[model samples]
Target: MRSKFQQRRLFEQTLNKIIGCNLKALPTTCLIAADDFNDEASFKRLVADLLAYDCRYFMTYGLVAEVLHDKIDEVISDLELGSKGILTAAHSDEPIDEIAWFFVNATAPEEDCVQYFFGFDDKAAFNELSRAVKKEVQKLNAKFND
Candidate 1:
């Protein structure tokens, strides 16, 4: 399997195009896997930051997954939603909270197994993530570029 660096480099090569795909709002696996394939560390951090939507409850109060989805996905959603310090592009006019929710609550990318492979851990990469996300928003859409 390609290392995290390999994956990140590949993604960086086309990061703008992929982010512009709006696939997170769609179901295209091509954008998901191709862009998300990162080294173990990078993948783990990205997934962790994306969050599972409900793991905070478990982490904070020791709540069991039984009452919830009882699945690990819920945990991932929580982390994604909880992390701070990620950047938001100006074009992503949506508030940071809303964006985080999107990453956390949105349906999973079918090719997201890479996240599980290293036990996605967002905290490890929140700083870098925020910067990346913030930059994306400010980038003028190609159609509107000078």
Candidate 2:
């Protein structure tokens, strides 16, 4: 398993890549804190500084998951209703109070977009998230190459 420092470094690298490749998209990246941690404050600041965007703190991972999984229209409606960091439960009867996942959405003005959802509880989750980010980068690069 990678150390916390290693994980943070990898996450930063991924974010940098997204920023470099999608600068014109005016991408708004969000770091979702699913659970409390010792270094959450520092991490939150890091994400905000790197993306120059806001970090959303959700009370439960279930609510964040629901927001992530919901259709764009639903999400927009929620946002329109002034639900920025405040997420209302739309699913999950019993919300688990565990370190769930981190959510990142790299959206372009056009139809091309990428959304990453991966847990930080284990190394596998981090690796999966890394792969997903790389795939998105590749797709974006391909569009420019062509």
Candidate 3:
């Protein structure tokens, strides 16, 4: 098993790559910069609020690829679209430990959905955030699927 530090490092690097990848492909997105956030905690709170608002598709494309540590370009490429877009990403000095996000539905208007991004500094916080996100996503999936 990877140590917490290793995991955090990998998560930050991969997440930064994912952000850059998507940004290159879709430059005109409503990309909110890291400087906008006061700290990691505020960012987490914002993500949680956004997730509750409308972003429900916890995409595994970037995340799964990161965990496997392969096919990164291909995985990022798979995220490209004319309508849907990544909502937010990590900023300078703020290394993200994990990311849980909702994939935009192609059939719907972009403005109709809200996207969420989260980052963490502490390993324990990351784990807790992950669990919370999972539970929320489950609730969201049930609501949306119904």
Best by lDDT: 2
- What is the TM-score (0 to 1) of candidate 1? 0.19
Give model 2's TM-score versus the native structure: 0.32
Residue 142 error, candidate 2, Å: 6.1
Judging by TM-score against the true structure, name the best candidate: 2
Query: Can you write out model 3's per-residue Cα lDDT over 48-119, one digit (the tens) per residue?
Result: 333333332222222222322122123233434213442323222322223322222221234322233333
Off by over 4 Å in 1: 1-31, 35-38, 52-146
RMSD of each: 16.7, 11.8, 15.9
Quantify all predictions' global Cα lDDT against the true fold: 0.26, 0.31, 0.29
TM for every model, in the order presented, reads 0.19, 0.32, 0.25
Q: How many backbone clashes does candidate 1 have?
A: 25
Error of 1 at 51 (Å): 0.7
**Global CA lDDT of candidate 3, please?**
0.29
lDDT pick, better of 1 and 3: 3
lDDT digits (tens) for residues 1-146 of candidate 1: 43221111111212223223222221111111121232544433433433421112111101221222222233344555436322211112335445333332232322222111111123233344343333432231111011
